[model samples]
Target: MTNLLLLALSAAAAVAPADNGGAPQQGLLPSSPWNVDYAEAECRLSRTFGAGADGYTLRIIRGANLKGVQYVVAGQSLKIRDWNHSGTLGLRPGERAYKLMVAWYRLPTGESAFQLLADDALRPDEIASTRGLVMEFDGAEPLVFAVGNLEKPLAALASCYDDLLTGWGIDPADIRNLKTAPDPLDLHTWHLYDDAWIGKAEKGKIWMSVRLDVSETGKAVGCHTLSPSGSAEVDTKVCVLSVKNARFKPAISTAGDKVKAPFILKIQIREQPATR
Candidate 1:
């Protein structure tokens, strides 16, 4: 989906947790403090926690063809150091844990948000039926929530997910073989040498970012530069090369099926002096 919230939610479904032995037994979980609200038009199922300064919202949104989860944290500031590539968020009921990749963003309301995503649909039963919810992220201490009843809320969320897919004419079976998109470029090969681009390559200090939408045939349909690398010529060159020269390993939706996907490229072009 084009919306950031939906994108994040779809990602959450992509990497769902497996039933490891420690999942909470199917029964009535302890009373949770979470409050649920459904927005059928948007296909969103949400739960709010902590009011005012210490508040956060947990959301599961159904996108055009994907599902995702968002943890919106507010009433505080986040330091750059708080975000590390190695940081992961874990959700556990009992001891069975589901680890998810975490991405951070700033909301228009000025609140900071963290998202967990994958590229597939999530099984609502796994989460709704579990109890004793505890979440751990980024080396910080675990946060425990009183998640009393998950059955009804998760069921509603699942329904919204189905509604989105059906409304968009997508079949769930077609998504089974879908795998996350991967980068095709060996960026190291593109780092300019001192003699390559002459003046531009002398220092090679260029910071640029690009976004690409790839077709199922492994071709980049469109590419746009997000940040310029100082030189217009250099910027244009990078985008052109990425779209024309880069080879992509098409995203597979089935053993023999390929699906369209989006890819992002961020490069800080800098030269390295000879070590010897």
Candidate 2:
């Protein structure tokens, strides 16, 4: 997910944050303009903070249905100590801190990075103010970016997201006044839950965000994966199983008519917890 409001931490070698040993904060100036990537599989928007550093990026990604988001951060001096490399992160526009979950990720440059996911703490619209981002990690120095309002940039992003839905064969008009979002037919799709466990990675977890194109008659007509990383076999199975087993209640319009709509699902694949 693009960090739409990520006035994030210090970054990798290319754009690492200032190494302030005992400094109180790593304050950054809004450096670059917002960049939106309309990729084949995802809609990502990003911007660089901290004096226009190449890697000082604040990227937030909205899901296909716009119900949730994911964000990524890369800090050069970030240290990891926990068994799962997980930590608590705080983001605030002014005073109230928004709590979020932070996890480790490997940047394409082979450096370590951090990311946040779809937890209740991050209510994007609530925190998406123009005040920029003030990020805090427990005992570490604060990461600050003096960015102004975000209303315009986010509007552009919403436009891009609508265009993406069209590309996936889902009508943008269908969701404008949706009385109900599509509901999953089952609690667990065994095909998907089972396929996710085969030959899983040795460590960490992967997030899979998928889009389902549901017809007015409550049938899945198309499937798309917003996250293109990880095993191709599992990716293929996601679509295959979706068509065969992924069922949903057709979205209802405010006019009391069933309408074709895009359904979104974000799932996490990780090792089953140790049950003694």
Candidate 3:
């Protein structure tokens, strides 16, 4: 992880200005060769840098469709001029040291989520005032990262953010209370139950299961479980939820002379109803 962080920092530091002659012309496509395509009828843009005499030229181009473009350098948001169309951004000779990328998407509903990617793996010291999700990658170039999905790399980032908060002595309740983006793992409810138990003088056995639901709004609504007797119990009372992850266990007892068996009950959470 430390090595990956050093590599990313080095890459960010290596960004340099393009030579005078190779600077992309006003009407030409952005100088970089990387491209992005949006499959859901949305606009996309990609940026790439090219080696030039002085350093490199950064080219950013619009997708087949026009979507707005914004960049964050040193934590400051800069609205790219003439970004409605393709354009070249001239990096000052020493200014290639910028290390962060903040991409903003104007969702179909006018809501937006900022996708923050760092050139360096985030160190505990680097995230002091950070208020959003953080992710780390340790692989080849054209490195990929994402957010807002349970199975994607961003999920790991969400976990890191939670850990950072905890490590800093920040109260989890306060962290959750802060106005932030909706949780991707908006689990409404989680349930765990045992089916049946069989016990003998020599051996015992048990069964267990769990269920949960996530909503479009990224909020978990209901979580519950049933005991072997088919009685409903609020599972949250016995579990601690950290961001999207949770840990829990049930109460059980065993006697030396008498073998005891336990069966898990049932657990279920309500998911968002399917759209017609």
- TM-score of every prediction relative to native: 0.50, 0.60, 0.19
51: Cα error in model 1, Å:
2.1
Better structure of 2 and 3 per TM-score: 2
Off by over 4 Å in 1: 1-43, 64-82, 119-125, 167-169, 176-216, 220-248, 254-276
lDDT for residue 85 in candidate 1, whole number 0-100 = 41
Best by lDDT: 2
lDDT of 3: 0.27
Query: Which regions of candidate 2 are displaced past 4 Å?
Result: 1-26, 51-55, 80-93, 118-129, 176-189, 193-210, 214-237, 247-260, 265-276
lDDT of 1 by residue, 1-276 (tens): 123233223322333332443222221122224434433223555554444433445665544323335443322333222344433333334445566666665554566565655344435665665553444455443434345556776677666655544553445454344554544756455443234444563245444556566788777777765455666777677777777766677766546567876555656565323221
lDDT of 2 by residue, 1-276 (tens): 123123243332223344435322325655679888886556777877654323456776765444445666654433442334344444433345546667665554444456665432244565475454555555544555544566666777778878977776666676557767676687475357664454552244455767878788777788887774377767777778887887788877889888777787666665433321
Q: How many backbone overlaps does candidate 1 show? A: 15
**Selected candidate, larger TM-score, 1 vs 3:** 1
Best by TM-score: 2
Model 3, residue 29: C-alpha shift (Å): 16
lDDT of each: 0.49, 0.59, 0.27
lDDT of 3 by residue, 1-276 (tens): 233334333433344222454321121122344334332211233333222321122212211111112321110111212222221222222223233444433322232223433222323432332221222122311211111112223233334444533443334344333222222222244322222212211121121122222233333333322222122232333222321453222112222121111111222232212221
Ranking by lDDT: 2, 1, 3
